[model samples]
Target: MNKTFQYVSYLWDEQKAKSLGDDQVALLIYRSNILGADLRITNYGGGNTSCKTIEKDPLTGKDVEVMWVKGSGGDIGTLTKSGLAALYVDKLRALEGIYRGIAHEDEMVGLFNHCIYDLDSKAPSIDTPLHSFLPFKHIDHLHPDAAIAIAASKDGEKITAELFEGQIAWVPWQRPGFDLGLQLRNALDANPGIRGIMLGGHGLFTWGDTAYECYINSLEVIEKASAFLATNYGKKRPIFGGEKIKSLVGSQRKEQAARIAPLLRGLASSYSRMVGTFNDSDTVLQFINSHDLSKLAPMGTSCPDHFLRTKIAPLVLDIPASQDLSDLGAVKSHIEKLFADYRDGYKKYYETHKRHNSPALRDPNPVVILWPGVGMFSYAKDKQTSRVASEFYINAINVMRGAEAVSEYVSLPLQEAFDIEYWLLEEAKLQRMPKEKALSRKVALITGSAGGIGKAIADKLAEEGACVVLTDIDEDRLANARKDFGKDAAIAVKLDVLDNDTIGQAYKAACLAFGGVDIIVNCAGLAISKPLAETTEADWDLLNDVLVKGQFKVSQAGVSILRTQGLGGDIVNIVSKNALVSGPNNVGYGTAKAAQIHMSRLLAAELGPDKIRVNVVNPDAVIEGSKIWEGKWAEGRAKAYGVTVEELPAFYAKRTLLNEIISTKDIANGVLAFVGGLLGKSTGNILNVDGGVAAAFVR
Candidate 1:
């Protein structure tokens, strides 16, 4: 903590607010963005804000006071006016009277629904009651890490009071509900001059007559908390020494993570079908490498806000400091037992805290895993959730570190964690998420994904919600592709498919990035047209290396990992129509592709018993954006067809019965259909993506 607000990035504009109608709601959205822009203030959908405004009631035709609060599941960082739910203030206040006898969460949700002022508004946040009960015109509640550090300490209340000099009230941990709302109101009534309230084991709330005042109030409190933490904990360091864990430190650690991720993924799938995203970031590595990791990690999250995402505690994998991670079979057995024990412990925790009306026990698998030698692994239904959990854990580590520096770090009671985890309002967010796409929890590996058909196939897989590992010899192009697809959805690895070492490394990286591969699209190839008599040995070797042997190596690596996970998978080889139909002066290219097609058929037969489907997609004349159709190759192909280079595309399309121009996207669609199990029971089959080329048809 710098004395000043070093991290605040509020870019609020008065004219922009005026442009949006210059009302309390506009100001609310503006301030929310300001507060949400910094992860230190609020992380991914973790905070809420509200404003008291007047809106016309359709039923009574009169202006009535309404509370416009952040809607459920809305992230303030990207929130809009429509993301705020409007509720009748009077009706909401009346709920305090009737909500006393009702303890059921469903009943409370229904009552909150009945208080909605606008039918078209989104569902109000579960914390709406606290904002509604407050007397201020504007209110903001955030779970800033700095505030959580102080609020989650052993003597959190005392530390909070000393830090803010009693300018803020401290409320003990209470599950969010109507009763907690009343308690907040009572605290405000008792401490009328307090500018803010720090909710123990939860978050902070500040309010004022205007949105700017409340926003500034939140910033001031966070700054003071940051200062206190820096003064006390700035020099503290982890107890572990780098030399003591040399084998488990630096670059080798990532290799260890890669080896263990697939094993953990397999174990997790035993509980559910959720995918695990392995993160070996500097933050995670530092935390996991600490000698006190077992002690700190089991101590629960820094705040209860993370419970919904990361659960009460992380599952700690028992990887010995000097263990030989190279022995994968032994490592797998060790991790299996660790996972089983973790599940048992989780069951015990649930048994101790569960209530009569609690929802059925969630999958006992931990959302976050702490493997000492490796790094943190976050598991969820898909990549997005796993990334969110990873972020929360990283922030929690920082907060816990700060708290430990000052004093002993403590978390909320396990009971409170369970309450929030099972809360109907919290559960509603998961329920409201749109149905997962066909390939939502799948991971795909696409070679030569820097551009052309491989790039298109990678994009399509990501669009369908698959975590994609993009591999290409073109490092710059692969980096750009990763940036375009985002870090959460895509990972880039420089892979020369022809090299056995690179193929093996790429497979390991894919497993490390996203559990293991569910689909492998072999789209790496080169076009070399030469007559059988003139084709040099170099051309034959190049074609065979990239087209035939490369596919086999990649498939073998992927299949080994897939078999270890024991999950059914898909393998789609991007062969060519030339594989079936010969063209003059194309011996080298056609021979290699034909060999790959036959290899795919053999692989399909061999891997069928393991539930892995192998198929081929033959795409012809995909000229647009195809690197194969460049320079002398395109001119020569045009000359062969008795047409100019400009007419080559139209010439090929006319030769097909469909008379349609084929594209890389068309080939990508064929790969997607095969990998998506459109032909689940059909293997050793070829799907044509050549606009219905009669000669290439493989009936």
Candidate 2:
């Protein structure tokens, strides 16, 4: 089939680009292709690119304009005014002498901090200092398809030398950021007038006096090398017609548009308020249906730059025409097998070629897949991500076609792709944060949270900046409680502890609503004041269900989500003071609380491997705004003490060393304390928030 290339211009509007301020222009570039699309093509933010904008900085005694680079975690497409972090050029260049001696990540992080405002943003992209060392006015580093096609081949050096004819210099792919940047600096120093640099199993870096020039050089360099490969390997026999493939992909595209339009709209609606506004119809369904998918898949990426969009691979499913395979377990299983085999092959390749830490095997999903009749699978993190992935695929197809025309295009090893995909330090950086302050992005679930102790713990956690999901069976009390805290203070859920399934569903809903859960405080418990003979089976069951079973179920669900994020979490259970110092009348409630204490310890021991910490907070005499302060709970106590209802609280408070009522806020603070750094390293340890009542009795 004679395929006609479609020109889909992604370049920004010239007027828009012109009107942008220096910071805005840099952001636009970072937001568009350079950062968003560029980082995705390799591994987790693998390839680095920076623009040398003239900016004023006070150094020595005079003010000078130096380059400020994109800080780490600064998603290019999502790049904002705060994303471009500053680094002094002289300081960056000076590191060239000692970059090799840095042994730990902290040293590199320190070096980056010396040149940047660490508090303002994430660690500057490891390439920040490297970009600072470069002499170019405008710079771009990418994993281009054409370059790697030649570089990853058996005769990579020979092929690149013949293709570029000594125009582009090549470097072996080293660990990126500091190490790789140092190597490149040395290479550039040795070879004075090099236009571009190609890292084996990595990508390409090019710079110029202007954006257009730099972009043009990138296009021209790849275009020439791709032309050379195509001249040699161009297909002579017309194995497939372009029209036939297009027709098949066209119909599938229509179906895909229908399936994804609503879904993309929903996702956009959910996230638009935060950042990265929604994609238009054209972008949302850009590559849903592609005509010549077979031809494109073999082409791989126009360069390695497509990884940011397509990922390392896509999840390929062979759907049978007779059955709806999307929901079929058998179909899903088959797809899983294909992904596993592909990953296994990648592992073997990695072991054979690379000598270093073994990369984590990512999900064996293909970044781009060829479906026989439906067309191609273009996968990405989101809508814009998909769009970027498709562009890389299109470019890769063009480069591969051109390279094939010149010669057989050699692909990179699967292991090399794995190295780029599962870079450990890169993965570590994505999850790195202060453990105590990590709850900022997390949602916390606290049960038995209405009035008294439960409400207190909920309030403290909310004040500490956690989005609290508070639940209790008291519908009226819970509603009034939420109102008291204000509408947006916390989410109030009516939870019946007796219903195990409902507790599980609540956990799931919290995750779906607010990303994932970081903490679970099981405080929804009740006390049954009765003699052992008077305590019925139903009363015993009720106590066990709320105090012991409910906490267990919710914590189970919370752990699963936490593990996916790769951050260990914490859980606090609200046990009663009676559990430690019990009376004959409180047998049922005390026994349930006893079981809860042991359960918390067991969970702590079991979950310690995953870094999930669990502990208990025992509260005494919490009767504010409750029947316990007026009715049956205070009835017998008042009579025995020969005191009034208000005096009962005072009597209990006086028995303690501090002589202060343990308010809901007191217990809540204890929960928050455990949530933070105040608890030291102890887990499974019981915290007494009872005004020293238990300590006095022990002494």
Candidate 3:
């Protein structure tokens, strides 16, 4: 172990402990956070921890020993006391005897559930027995990549001994269950002096009398594995392809990804519905573009923990280094065959490992797909999961590289991987998650999304679980808007609605970012409220270009991508009440908006055969959070109404039957009602979001 890698202790601070109230629980959370904060120790939800403590039993008014293990679905890094489920120690320990005859995995889960001390507490982690069975006050189990690299090696046992000098016990890979728990318990009993246990093909387990001790032990073991890998394997820089490969793949990798991602996404959709995000960074590109990727990638995941996120193996698309990626038809045909082959391979893997009670076959779509010319694409139902799978697979590449540098990289046996994949406990963790949001797995693209009604719509769509693409002419504001939504929920693109090329590029970016968009919100517009006689040809052209032509171009681009994906989609245009009821002197703005409404109807009629729906929202006076009604436009409108600027908002509100001012959020809600399928089977409809503007209501 590297003795010099200092471990910072957060539990020793009295003030911090005082705030949490329970010193022991505070210490446990502190240490768990420490483990989670470091990707080298654990990534996301890859590990579990536990602490044995004495707490007063509210019913009996007596102190009782309880095992507070990490609750199901809890990530150690951000875990709190509430995230830990407490089980009565004596009752949980008694299960060891009862579990002897219980071979069925489902029965074991029932038993674990029955042992929960608090009725309201979360289900305990499956490894609860592994911790309870061990005679330790504090325990930490993690799937650290370094430890996994050593554990998944051909001579893992020998390497473990050399690195830890018999300080840790080695248990052969066992499917995590009652039997595996027993094996772990018996192994520790025989090696009573060991500080930790390394499960072959799995991960590391360490325990101590205190949180700091257990944490440090985990750190020491990981440091030892890292040091061993560094000393034995030595670092090998990935081979960036030669000029030939680079020239063939194209000098612009990002542009190549944009072009190729849609084909891959479309192909993947044939097997199952999923969204894909592209990765073409230096590290990912270096790994994917390597000559030896074909030999290295199929070996398997770095550890069994990855089986749930990333499938057992990635699907490698064989794009010839000499081929051009610009040919969409060729790329599409190749991807179709690759997806079919990958699905067939997965089915065969399942058939070979099928058991009488094995879980149902999972979606056969590949989570990780490696394209030679265009880096990697990770697919999931949502952007977050796709990104997570990408991270895991990228790390897998590094782990495999390190292991191969020293020795052959060996993953768990196929059956073991299958066991983890089908384990009832892991399945339960997924089942325990909250119901999917209304727009879960859906992708939305909003135009003019930098601020106001457009941004509101973007926020609402994302809140409903849709990955959004926000576009605007204001690049800085668009970037800031994307940042506000975070990378997981939104991506930004600078777009001029009037430019056909930019509109097409934005559609491609959406496809590259999230498979393909399911919803298109056209909110970009220009307002010029002038008398018909005063309106100039240039004024009419500008409004027509931005409000009518721009929207038409965006819709055209969006529908093309949607058609290629073969998935039904929705288009909601943010028009104005002026379209329904013409206001005096607003010739250009009203005429263009009226054209948009008519265009949407035409589009709906044409696209209904493809299951595409087109709808329009007519908002009257959205003064607050409305960029359209600001500065000169607001002043002109107020003057036209013969009212002060401050009174203009009130005047418009009082004109409505509801006598209420409309907000951007109100308009967004109306759009959501249509696009989110609340008005199912209804298309070519106009939703009036003008706070009860009766004249604007669709007749």
**Predictions in order: lDDT:** 0.82, 0.58, 0.80
Tens-place lDDT digits, model 1, residues 515-576: 78889999988888766787899999999999999999899988987887777789999999
TM-score of each: 0.92, 0.47, 0.92
* Number of clashing pairs per prediction, in order: 0, 41, 0
Top model number, lDDT? 1
Ranking by lDDT: 1, 3, 2
Identify the superior model by lDDT, candidate 1 or candidate 2: 1
Ranking by TM-score: 1, 3, 2
Q: List the residue pairs that clash in candidate 1.
A: none
Top candidate, metric TM-score: 1
Q: List the residue pairs that clash in candidate 3.
A: none
State the displacement of the C-alpha of residue 554, model 3, in Å, after optimal TM-score superposition: 2.0
Output the lDDT of residue 634, model 2.
71
Which is better, 2 or 3, measured by lDDT? Answer: 3
Q: Write the per-residue lDDT of candidate 3 for residues 324-360, one digit (tens) a residue.
A: 6556676676678888888999999888997887778
> How much is 589 displaced in model 1, in angstroms?
1.3
